[model samples]
Target: MNVSLLANSLVGSEIIKIGNEVNEMKRKGAQISNLTIGDFDPSIYPIPDELKEAIVTAYNEHQTNYPPADGVLALRETVSGVLKSRYALEYNANEILVSGGSRPLIYATYLALIDPGDKVVYPAPSWNNNHYCVLSSANGVAVETSVENNFMPTGDQLKPHLKGATLLALCSPLNPTGTMFSAEQLLEICDLVLAENKSRSADEKPLYIMYDQIYSLLTFGKEHVNPISLRPELRDYVIYIDGISKALAATGVRVGWAFGPEVIISKMKSLLGHIGAWAPKAEQVAVAKYFRDEAQVDTFLKEFKGAVQKSLDTLYNGFQEMKKEGFNVDAVVPMGAIYLTLKIDYIGKTTPAGDLLKNSADLNFYLIHEAQTALVPFSAFGNDESVAWFRASVGGCSLEDVYAMLPKIKTALSKLK
Candidate 1:
């Protein structure tokens, strides 16, 4: 059967592919420590009691109708306050657009800004910007970042690509790597972007930034920085993606927002409205009321981040121990988010079963079968399969699970020669 080229050419998420394989093994009674998906195991990281109760109360009050096309107004208002209080961002409700989750907001950002063949530049191993570019029919540029920069793209690395680009997709406490940009690093990039915009003609679409800070609130000790915060003049050119999904362990609740210039935001709101991608009315109402209490939000973050950090630290230290023991493995210090950047450079080795580990994927699967451990290779995040670095997401795993998997991974690597 024939299909639209876009539909036929669309690639599925690699993380979901690996996660499905692990889940299937688990269903077959395999004892696998699944670390593939960037989602919380609600059993270990439950949503705040106050927020959950608010959700129930909203539902009981019959707030089940379809939400406003942009989002519930009250939720937008609350999100506005959050911006002012948390990040010193002063976007009003009119400038905010809410959707079911950050995914739609991100997609909407692409659709609103990118014309066909327009260039979209993002750092490789960052996240789904490549796929989004495909979906939007834009020319995608994946700037390869180095491990020396903790996999975060530096201004010098991204400067050359900014010319003639329509959008620059960026993230901090970045997905897949759990690394962040220092203020100086982001400041440099911000200056480059400002200069790029200045170089563009007025009729030309200025280079816009789709800044995905979904993991902003989950940072361990590092402060989350934004392009506008560093360069307020860039306010009109930056759209921020954030929500309660990571911060409140409420991924299932489906509430995310994008704030930017009113004109751009209005277009995105119209796009989402046509798609009918609003968050549930009840969840929006619940979040509006629940998030208004700054004290409660801070209290929950303190405990939630503590648990997430403990798991990240455990995995980082475990991999460092293996490196000290002469295993072909290493890990970056946990900076933020629930991921630990890992180096499992055993791609050319042979498994005990005589299978040649040809690439990161092969090495990952070998560990899944031989050591009952699972991780996402950088290939899944737009890197080549030969890249030995992998992302270990600890959101779904407990500290005990992380502790137990280390020795198994070491044993599995030891058997590979």
Candidate 2:
């Protein structure tokens, strides 16, 4: 039986593969500290009490029905107000499109803006931009970023690719790296975008930006920056993706929003409507009430940040201590998000059984089986196979779990001949 070409050609998620491996080990009673998935263990980090209650109330009131394709008018208005208050972004309610989660909004952005063969530029070792490009049949242009810039691409690196690209996908408080764009760095990129769009005539497809700021509120000691916020002139060409998934520890709530040009937003609404991807009406109603209370939002963020920061700090400090002890490990400072950019650079070393470790994937499996810890290597995020860097997400583990895992990691590394 022949499937659609896209279905046949699609590679399975590397993250899921690693997750399944972890699950199998755990099922066999191997106490593995699984850190591959970028999701919170709700038991360790639950959604806010107020928001949860509101959700229950909405459901009890029989708010379960098909929501408007663009989201309920009140929810869109709440999102608009939240943006205006926090980041000074001032899109109207109609300019915003609500969906099940950030994934659908991102997919809709790709579908709405990109025609087949259109070029989509994004930094490698980021998120799933490559897969999105394949789904949309767009030309994926991967910009190689380096650790010197916190693994973020600069304007100079992106300049050559921007000439004919349709979308420049970017994210701040970036996933995998747990790093963010400094205001100055992002402003420079915004300036480049402004210039590129200015050069295009009315008839040409203008260069647009898909700024995914889902992890913006998770930054630690760093301010989140966006293109339009820095260069207001570039406002017309930027689409912003955000939601409560990270900030409020509400991933399963299935509420996300994207705001951009009215034309693009309208098209995305129609597309999502046909796909039946709107956020549940009860969840939408709950969020609308929850978002309007500024004091509660502040309180939730303060407590949530404290918990997340502790987990990140523990993993980051553990790896740093291993480095100081002359182990073959290193880690970047955890600036934002619930991930620590870690390096288990033991490639080419021999295991105790005389098997030579081959690549980052090999190291990843060694950590899973030997150390009883799991992590997603940077190579999984569109990097070359040789990059030994990996992302150790802290959201799924406890501080006590981190304390127990470090010794195991050290012992495992010592056994590598």
Candidate 3:
């Protein structure tokens, strides 16, 4: 029999709908300009000479046997050092768990912290996984905060969800919206959790925090602030999740880590021991070396920052040009992260039965059939109730490609209106 509950609740992404439509149109001989990608574009950026050399050097030579269950010992130590270096927060190697990707690390943390019917707080327009992961695999509750407050959660705004939640899943430089809370605001939320925890006993439920900083270092003009930096004394309360996927553009490398209290990380590692166990021996060795050399890490950061900034600028200018051309676009320039969140409400729209069109999903479908463009709806990221919004992953597109897509974007938004 087919599985019921979480697995059954998992639906395919809404953006894929537009993408499949474009593919069908292309099959019918309609030319379509593609702007709907979420990963980095293929560019000829010089890969770190050392990492490349190491990959070749370490090939099959490393302990090719099943690596340690919690990941290679050396890699865990290196990740520990990285945590300390980045935020002056220290972690024992035992407190860090290696994972296939940040997604697994996130899912594993949810498994470790959450139980049936537990609530998990997330802001609207976040990484689609923030809620979907909880709902799809576990019997946890997904609570949505609005986009009106710039998508960052105020404690009061979040407390209702946080009330009985086993954990709070958060993303800085959020997914679709690319918004982040200030360092102080982050502490305020953490403080609220502590206060809330104080109201209960040690035997009572404790709400943990799974704070994702995968996009932490990729900020554009703004200071890339981290919450751990605010109050290192309370480190045990927060689980810091991150990986090389965003930093080194090594997404497929599938290397990520979870750093948190021994109790939480221990349980997560126990789960990983059964699920993914240690990372690939070679990749772990490579990432360990990559983390060890601070100079190399700094050099890589410098180059990546430049490339991502240029990409963000290209997106910024494209949206500005669209605004100038009379399209009502809400361009929230992300200071960091690899996406552009656009709200195109000016397009004239109506339902098929002639009812006025409403919400991002309606606009998304209109764009596909009429505009011949494919982009994910903001609702896919958990926005709801008539919020008309869209997101494009311009991480991989060139400035030229980004510019060329605007007319297509306008055409798509136009069809909906």
Candidate 4:
């Protein structure tokens, strides 16, 4: 049987590839309390009345024509203001490019810059899509740094893999574990990459850095971190990926923007101009309108932080109780994103097939079957060696429900000694 090499190299998502097998069990009269799927609570963030009005107005006004290739002028202008206010980044509208979601922005970045066989570096147990997107779309190798160090990666990790490298996709206040790099730590990385780029010489193109700030508004207690803040000289080499999904709970609208040097944005926009043709015209107008009124962004951010904090507290308490109950687990506390990693060891407990539970994937399946809870195994996130670590997303459920889900999770592994 003949198949594509890239397709062969790609790994499927254990979390979703399970294909509703558990969900089907859940449907057939089973009490399924879902702890999987990192969806925000539907109640806290409903579509705003203003956005509804905009959509209707667009429909009535027949604003249905294809938009400009880059994005609507107002949206790009608003994005410029957002970068200035939030990250202290001075971006012109030309540097702002919009896509359906940050996922495409990643691919667009890869398409805009990468040559075949370029080496790409990222921190591990990362967003699954980044790895695949680089490998499948760009045919680039992904250099993964271990998450054992509280998920803060260093330049040393990239040294061995920089031979033909072109892009470094970085996500802070990252997905899965929610860890953010300290300002100093981010500087350490950029300094090294830029130095390495110089040593390699003028013939070699610069190593592009794409910083994903999708969860920018969700940070609580800790200061917001960005590479542009520290390394001003690398402005041309940096790309910022941010969105209103988490900020406005508008994930359904799939709006995200990229901020970078005008040249890179110009290249990416040329590509997106053909396919995306301005990010959802109606949604762009609404965000643009809202940008004029800072009060909405401010109030929404406050509520967002509050809702996220309440959920984090509930999950923290859940882990604490489990610890008190003698469960062997580590709390990988996150600074921003809605989820955190829980490392569990189910060793010596034995498995149904007489094979000892060996890795995170096995434990994930067992929990979903026996515990009736869904977790994104570290295995899915590219950590296969370690056993019994999985993620719990708190924002998807309310505080009480989050507390309630913990006991259900504990139910499966309680018998372990």
Candidate 5:
């Protein structure tokens, strides 16, 4: 049976495929330290007490009906207020659109702005920009990044591709790297985007930016920067994607938002409205109430950031120790997000059983067995499959879990000859 060409051509998530492999090992009673998925294990990191209680209360009050096409007005207003107070972003509620987590909002942004065959430029070793481009029939140009710049794409890397690109998909506290754009770094990119848009004719579609700042509040010491916040002039061309999934450790709650030019936002709301992807009404109501209490929000954030930081620090320090001990292992200083960029460059090395580690996927599987650990390789995020850099998500693990895996990693590396 033949299906639609788009359906047939769509590429599935490589991370999910690796996750399934980890699950199969776990089911067989393997003590696997699985760090493939970009989600929090609720047992390790639960949602805020105030927000959780509000969710229950809202349900009890029978707020389970269909939500407004755009979203409940109250939640939108709360989101606007939080952005204004925290980031100094002055978006009105009317410009905000709520959806189920950031995924739908991102997809809607692509569909709303990109026509078939348009170009979408994004940094590789980032998130799922490649798949989104495919879904929208846009030509995806992935700018490869290096560790010297903390795995972030620079203006020089992106300038050549900016000429005719319709969309520049960017994420800070970028998913796989756990690194963010410094103010000066992001300012340079913003300047480039501003110039590109300025060069476009009024009749032509201006180059737009889809800035994903979902992990903005999760930054350790570095400040999270956004395009509009850096260059207010680009506000009209920037669409922001953010939510509580990362900050609140509430991935399951499924409340996310996108705010930008009223024109693009209106079109996005229309697209998402037909798909009926509005966040659950009860969760939306609960989050709105949670946002209004500044003290409670700050307290929860303080505690939440501590837990996430502990795990990230454990991984970063552990890998550094290994690197100092002369192992072929290194990691980036985790600045933001729940990920640690791990470099285990063992390609062409021989494993204990004389099997050769040929690529990133091979290195991943070897660690799964030899060290009883699982990690998502950079190849999963649109990089070449042979790269050894991988993303270790700490959201699902505990401090003890990280420590226990350290010796296992050392022992496994020792076996490589």
Candidate 6:
């Protein structure tokens, strides 16, 4: 069973492990309200009809061949226009590199920028930057953030770590917490990055930023901000990760793009090219045609985000109600994305079965079995196991499911001593 050290030491995804447990329970006839994975159940949230039809059309037109290593030029052009129209950021097609999904683009970013033992600074409770650092052989620094900042890292917390870092990974409408960085918050961090880079010699590797805004379009009412937009001078140092996976409920469609300095993007392109990670030609073609109609895209977002918000609101309000009822539970207001940050502070409590709820994971599994509900603990996202926070993704459940699960959770908690 000897394998490469990298393969042997690599840890599997904790979220996926929880999801697999949920799936196994479901297969055994358990009616589990699985909120572990950050994915949409197509039944509750289907892709836009226009986009789906375009995908079919592209396939019918025989766009089934492998796409160019970077991406379909038309799709890149459409992405360029999207940046201009949506975010007021400007990046031409050549500067954009599209891949199967944000994962490949993210991994490519790491491979292009990191060398073994190079430091990679990222906030704890982020999506997968820790694993990406491991895969890229970079020394990962997970800065612990406080709930006061909604689990998003502050400049002061990250400043001391940026001294010799090769990459600073950031995400807004951040995963796990569904929190976002305010303009002031992001601008502060951007200034820090600028200052750090300014102090570096040209011969030394500059600190690059990998900004993941995959949920940028999924915001509730808050504005999504980016480093480049706040500090235009930092444009060449940032690489953006975005796509239709979350925006269009098209995770399976596998079309994501990264745009930055042409030189860095070209390096990422070559890296991904060798890995054969291009988005399917048909899907790329379909996305290009569908995204060109801004009005149509806006119409879809208006309705889609409305549904996602309803689910998030239901869960938030339910937890707040429980808190008012003297439960040791709370929730952050839904800001963006399909997740609600929940505080189920029953870690030290004991279940009626006399088993001590030792940590967030234990409490989570208790709810899964007793409440028939599931969630991902912050520990899975790099926090200490004692942290009682968890992420409940609403994309897999309907508003009714969320409403129904609240009473079950209340009942389950009531049974805990």
Question: What does candidate 6 score in Cα RMSD to the true structure?
Answer: 0.8
For all predicted structures, in order, the TM-scores are 0.99, 0.98, 0.89, 0.91, 0.99, 0.99
Clashing pairs in 5: none
Alpha-carbon RMSD of each model: 0.8, 1.0, 2.9, 2.5, 0.9, 0.8
Candidate 2 structure, TM-score to reference: 0.98
**lDDT for every model?**
0.93, 0.91, 0.71, 0.72, 0.92, 0.94
User: Model 5 segments beyond 4 Å from truth?
Assistant: none
What is candidate 3's lDDT per residue for 1-417, written digit by digit as tens?
A: 389666766677766766687778889997655556566644633446787677666675754767787888898999888778876877889998888878777878877776665666666667755454545344444456655666677777777666656677778877776667777667788877877777778897787777888887777767655556776655667887888777777766778898888898889888878776456778888888877898888888887778767766776677788788877786776766777677777434674456455666666666655555566777777766366667766665566666666677676556442
Residue 57, model 3: Cα distance from true site in angstroms: 1.9
- Give candidate 2's whole-model lDDT: 0.91
Off by over 4 Å in 4: 1-10, 129-148, 351-355, 385-387
Error of 6 at 327 (Å): 0.3
Per-residue lDDT tens digits for candidate 1, residues 180-201, read 9999999999999999999999
lDDT of 6 by residue, 228-274 (tens): 88999999899999999999999999999999999999999999999
Please report the TM-score between candidate 4 and the true structure. 0.91
By lDDT rank, best first, the candidates go 6, 1, 5, 2, 4, 3
lDDT of 4 by residue, 1-417 (tens): 388876676665666764376678867877655556666656755555565576677767777677677777888898888778867889889888887767777777887887765667676667764564645365444455555656667667766765556777788887777778888778888897778677787777888888988887788789878887898888878988887777777777777888898889899888877666356777777777775566777786787778777877677767777888888866776678787777777745666555566666667667777777666776666555564666777656666676666887787776444
Compare candidates 1 and 4 on TM-score and give the better one. Answer: 1
Off by over 4 Å in 2: none
Please provide, for model 5 over 1-417, each residue's C-alpha lDDT reduced to its tens digit, 9 standing for 90 to 100. 389889998888888888888889899999999888999999989999889999999999999999887888999999989998899999999899999998999999999999999999999988999989889999999999999999998999999999989999999989999999998888999999899988889999999999999999898989888898889999889999999899899999999999999999999999999999999999999999997777888898898888888998999999999999999899999999999999998988899798988899988999998899999999989899888899999898888999999999899989888
Candidate 6 Cα misplacement greater than 4 A, ranges: none
